[model samples]
Target: MTARPPTVRERRLAGELRRLRESTTALNLEEAAEGLGWSKTKLSRIENAIRKVTAAEVQQMLALYSVTGPRLDALVRFSRTTRQRGWWDVYENSLPTDYATYMGLEAESEWLNSYTMGLVHGLMQTEDYTHHVARSILMRFSPASEVERRVAARMARQRAWTERADPTRLWTILDETALQRVIGGPEVMRAQCRRIIELTEQPNVMFQIMPLAAGGHPGVVGSFAILGFPERFTPNVVYVENMTSALYVEDEREVHTYALAFEQMAAMALSPEESVAMLERLARQ
Candidate 1:
């Protein structure tokens, strides 16, 4: 028997609702159930993501709980977004649950703020370059076929704003060392730079380079992506990607910290014009 796939969006909604419920003075599940006109079991299902939560219902509960103003609006919006389906859904089984959640956020984000130390950030990588990077991991996992499929899915997920009329605006600050570091060698590096140049030309895209000379920045720790959704429905999320897994943080304080860190990274990065010149410099080398 096949194990049931993780319901990423459903789980996210359920978790968010649960957190909201916890923060309120519900006093008892029975009281909360009567207030929302839901049975205890139904409430439990929504909280567990075993059942989908309706945005209207969520808003109603928030209103009843006195969760007002912008935060209430944000939670309402999040409930609606749980219905957002992305292309990455096909590979749900191939990637880990957290990775899948990250992909969905990346796809829907209107503005993406990313910082990569020296390695390739998934969104900025060329297809073959990604293969070279992912190939290294294939050796560790079972089922060679599953590995290939995931690589292809990863590559597919990376295709952002290639054709969108108003594609996501990507504001990226990559270490200058990243330009010098050849991942798959000269050819791959050249193509990657060319791709960067192409992506930067998009009206919504912004690519900046943080030179070695601009030392001691927030991103010195690792990579982080701050995703701003289009509809302004949810709180901004910070995605921290590691070798093994990724972390999505949405706590107000944590998000604020990452936002400030991204701003500092941007200040340390080269100006847009200078960044383009640096890309050209890399491509010519």
Candidate 2:
């Protein structure tokens, strides 16, 4: 039988757990293992994320490591959510394992902040616009027919913005260059820009632009996002996309850095009231 696919999140958690263990003083681990009445092997598996680690055990481990402050609390909470299923599980057969994990995170996010360097966020994209983007992106691995289905799946994912009873809130920052890049030509770009204007008016959505004239910005780091949860039971995480792979960061410090950057982007970009006006102006051109 095939091994269960390791989620990008799981692999990361395991790596971090192993790093913590490797760097831990033997005496500290010994004392903690003894107090918890757990075998060293068992602790190892937990740290490796090879098996489930209960919140109680994680709490004990954190205590042993003297990991106090909000970081500890956040780690414990993240452990609890590590096992919860994400909606993208249904499309497991369609997407690559790592991309499946990304979809799950997207599905479960309570609040998502995205900055686009080249195109619009998928959540804010119209079906045609998303199709154009997905097919172009998948040109390497998939044939034309397969790409169409994948494009459909991507567009379906966007339905979360409008179809959910309680939709995930999205705050997206698009660059003026991306909008001006003319996705499907002048008519299509106008539609896309108009869609942005409409979505920005939703009570739960915010759309804004970073004018090329705004010059350099926090997003000069390229595109990234922070996915926040409504429940305190989970730690907020940052998602980063690189050329070869995507990464998830759950460390509160890292998450906050991205979150602060997002806040700055929102503040420095147009206000929501003016953002709509800005989009309207762009769509007209």
Pick the TM-score winner. 1
Question: Which window of 10 residues has the lowest lDDT sum in candidate 2?
Answer: 1-10
Candidate 1 residue lDDT tens string, 1-285: 114543556556676667667766654666788888889988887777777667888887787677889878877777776655668788777777778778776777788888988666677788877776777666656676766776787778766455556677888888888777767789899888888888887788788889899968888888888988765435577888777777778787999999998887888789999998988887888
Residue 45 lDDT (model 2)? 64
* Candidate 2 per-residue lDDT over residues 135-199, each given as its tens digit: 77776677777677667667778775478888888888887778778776787788988887777
Clashing pairs in 1: none
Residue pairs with colliding backbones in model 2 are none
Q: How accurate is candidate 2 locally (lDDT)?
A: 0.72
* C-alpha TM-score for every candidate: 0.83, 0.78
RMSD (CA, Å), candidate 1 to true, equals 3.6
Evaluate residue 23 in candidate 2 and report its C-alpha lDDT on the 0 to 100 scale.
Answer: 53
